[model samples]
Target: MVAESGNGVHLLYPVDLLNDEANRDLIKGVLGTVAERFDDDDTKLDQSVFNAARITKLYGVVANKGDHIPLAPWRLSRIINAPERNAVVTIEQLRALVPVAPAKLPAAKRRGNYPAFDLLDFLTRLGIGYRQDMHEGRERFKLDHCPFNADHGCGEAAIFQKAGGELGFKCQHASCVDYRWQDVRELLDGPRESRAGRATANGNRPGEQNAATGTAGALRVTYRRVSDVQAQPIRWLWQGRIARGKVSMIAGNPGLGKSQLTASMAAIVSTGGLWPVDRTRCTQGNVIFLSAEDDAADTIRPRLEAVGADLNRVFVLDAVVESYTADGAEVRRAFNLKNDLAKLETLLIEVGDAALIVIDPVTAYLGDCDSHKNAEIRALIAPLSELAARHGVAVVCVSHLNKAGGSDALMRVQGSLAFVAASRAAFLVAKDPAGDGTRRLFVPMKNNIGNDQTGLAFAIESAEVPSAAGHIETSRIKWGAESVTVTADEAMTSQGDPEERSALKDAKQFLIELLKNGALSSKVIRADANGAAHSWRTIERARVALNIQVNRAGFGKGGIWTWRLPHTPPNTAIESIERHTNCAAAYEKSGGLCEEKPKRNEPDWEEF
Candidate 1:
């Protein structure tokens, strides 16, 4: 019979069948053949309805999906067509039409030496909620939550106990694809602490008596002598900047290419590329990047691709699978550094060749810890430091710079000083003092494991990377020349120096007089600034200070930037004024184009 299934149609085949194994196999093969033959883009055959005992929707029933949308209105499901005489599909015809041989059955479950333990009793003892039901002649318990990773919100996992006394676990989430019955079995029934091997609340085993001693009830502390300890040399990821088997931090203000800088480092490690400072080849390995601020697809992946990173070697730890709900639902949440480091360690072991772990803006993963408290910060970082050292991976924590002007570079890190103290090396990303605003300096703030190294300058520039959705625009780091002399502190100091302030003041006056006749192209202004023996950096600073208006004149390849003094009338024909120390004399020299003071009711005009 052909029936309308509300939004679509369903074809039903009636067959004389039994609930035996042979009949089930025959029906399964027939359904599979029919599904494969008729499946298409717009319609799909329901493969899950092949079981002989499954229920079907009754004809003439109201098939209201209750979506309450115009496209999915309620409809009556009824038979559309029926044959004059019902003819059953023959099992021999189905066997003949089978397109390919049936797939091989799974190997028999290996019970081995595992004892028959009550699964329900075990789950209840562990305080795990579950709903029990029968599935395919076996007892199946739908877990309230996924035991492997609670973060998965979908309810598609269950624990089934077969009639043959075999246990199985299955979760439909892609994240839990690697999970097996053995993993869940171990999770629920940890190490078998039988009636004999279990330890008591005190430091003694059952039936054991403690002798009378002064150290009774005191915890046991073990110590090793220096002679028994083996020593090792420090390994460097980037010599004198980032060290392997240790914690490192990179701090900077926003828009300083901190993320791009980390991506560059990841790219180097992923592809075994050369370091920017030292031209040494790094060990090719996998990288785990946990970014809380940027999206992996649009922001992180494009940057990695732009830098020619081995995309396969780069992994993003987006979130931790926390737990599962009772109906086989997964509960996922953010990866907290405090509680999830153990989980991260487990992942690193699985990745095997992981050489780097980057936690961008480490502050985002602090997880309720007081950022400014030394004790809490150290407690959180100590294990992370040990994990990195144990795994021989360099963990770089990206952080933001606090607005503490003229302070030491180490002090400018946004959190407690413990972050820098715990780290073997700390670097600062600051704007380069010698270049225009585009250049940035990656200078050392503190280094305890390597010699003093000169800072490297880099610029963030836009690049096009091919993605599934064609090309996209994203920024990547372009490493420039090394800053052999200037450091982070020196750069920060010069930015606020009185002498530099005076030079910026001079540049502003020069810009006003140069553009007094109206807008001038940026190229002309820069060329004049260079001719005046002023760095383009200072001139750009002056422009920002004066709120200069910059506009592009054309589109695409022919576009050019034109700079105008803010509020300057377009095409105004005004006389130019000579550079002078006396502000009043310059105002008179320009026919009042440069104003020393505003007229009684007029708005203020900037001086030359």
Candidate 2:
């Protein structure tokens, strides 16, 4: 048995430190010490004892007189039963047995292909640690210390080396001349550099040299002739140059036959007929007329037939398919332009392309008009515009005037100003101020893409036509008109009370005189009436009292206030003045003068 101070017992024949018996006895003593430290009932103690016995047997430790003897199971059993009291082993003692010298192994047996020492060095730098499992007599490498080791092993030392420690161990192979750390690091870093070089040379790898080069020369190129191209201006086939993709508001009092006139226009376009415009002809193409308010069979079909529209060319959507529900209430949904565009694409695939798509009364399709929210409205209409542009279809969205009457123009549309702003073109339909009920006026309110100054005045008549079943059908017409007029008191009293009538009468007279020349400043007029100290509140009160029309003109320093006459006929004005004068005379006869008393700077002369 070989022994040294602080070293555990080593049973060896020649007492060689590197002999199998020395290593086995040393491991046996360590395992015995571990078993004693733990309780007998502990499963780990029994497992450690069994593992140490098996490791000793594999290392060729046995009691026999030969160069290599078969390990004896009885000898191991005896050592386990009569464990050495003072000869004990610890984690530190087991780790100290690991060979630190590369030349320890026989030089003749060295493998030429052994990894370099830097490889191991790199691994240690990358936070690798190791432990020797004396329980199995095989050195086990671990990234952390073995908790079972009583001395805590080399865990602290290993961690310290990983954090920038230069200390390193020779390769485990005794003949390997290189250090473990240097060989390992060189192997890892060398291959990485080679891979990077190959990738750069390829120039096709994603997010590499190729990507950078490709983006460097990315520039938008546009071609144009040096001189202006001698191209003829393309004119719209429709008379009066109906601009492409614009909203034309067609409004009238509830029963002014707006729908009938719109149907007539649709019929002319569907059959490629002439519109009222002299120089322009209708751009003959397929026409889609969506009327949510009218039934295809009863109202729409007969009207189109009476106007001599080609039945094959005109497509009327079934009311059932177009209906939608909002807030549990069933309402005729307005034609969605996006949906119609998709449907139009399908239609084009089947029957060439379409030229016109008309949506009557855009309000019915808009689920929420009273909502002041702008984003919601834009989201809804954005799809519609995209559809029109994608399909190259001219969309004519029809809208109605607000109940509030004034300028029978685009400004009177029922919803947000965005409605007019979004549309490329817009028109307004109003009762002719000079004609009777027979005459109607179609005024162009906004013409962003074309001229819209002149309006079309036509007399409307419902004519009868024989259908396929021989039934008489009525359709509206566009004929010559005689006159149209709406009296101020008649218009006001038609809906409101006597107070409204009086207010409207005074307002109409005041506006007619003020706007007869042009627009006038409300501030200037107010100052003249109420001195230089006149307040805006007083001006507003006078506006309400007199019922004059007022609107803002500009902003900041350039801002001004302007007034205009309500859009009413001259006869309506003359009649309103006469009625107010008669009412004042009647009040005077009844002992209550209705006339305003002149101010101190004014003359007071009364005349009927």
Which candidate has the top score in TM-score? 1
Q: Which residue ranges in model 1 land beyond 4 Å of their true spot?
A: 1-228, 325-329, 494-608
The residue-by-residue lDDT of candidate 1 on 1-608, one tens digit each, is: 79898867888877776777777756656665676587665776654465777778887888765333334567889898987767788777767866465554334433222344666677777565778888755578887776644434345788877543456788876545545565565443432222123334566543456564433343233468999999987887876778889999999888889999999999999999998856888988899999999999889999999999999999999887778999988788999898899999999999888899999989889887756555557778889999998999999999997654443576568866678878988888888766787888888888888754578889898999987889999989988745455676766654455676689789988997776666655765787899998899889878886788887665574445677786775434121111122333454578765554321222235542
Q: On residues 1-608, what C-alpha lDDT tens digit does candidate 2 reach at each position?
A: 33211112333222224436556656544444554465342243322332223444323343322112122112321232233455444546664543343222222221222222342445566554665332233233443532111122344222112111122333322122222333233323432222232322334432343454554222223357957767644245354445434333444445666777777777777878877645346767777777778888778878888888887887865433454566565554444542454654566456545767677766566543221223333444556666666655666767765544332244346554446656766665556644464666665666666666566666666677776777865757674433223432222223334454455455445444444534445544554445534345444544554456666555664555666444534343344344434444555587975463222221121210
User: Lowest summed lDDT over 10 consecutive residues: which window, candidate 1?
Assistant: 573-582
Q: Tell me model 1's lDDT, rounded to 2 decimals.
A: 0.74
The count of residue-pair clashes in candidate 1 stands at 18
Tell me the whole-model lDDT of each prediction, alpha carbons only.
Answer: 0.74, 0.49
TM-score of candidate 2 on Cα atoms, chains taken together: 0.43
Off by more than 4 A, model 2 = 1-237, 245-253, 277-279, 319-335, 338-340, 366-372, 389-392, 404-408, 468-470, 481-608
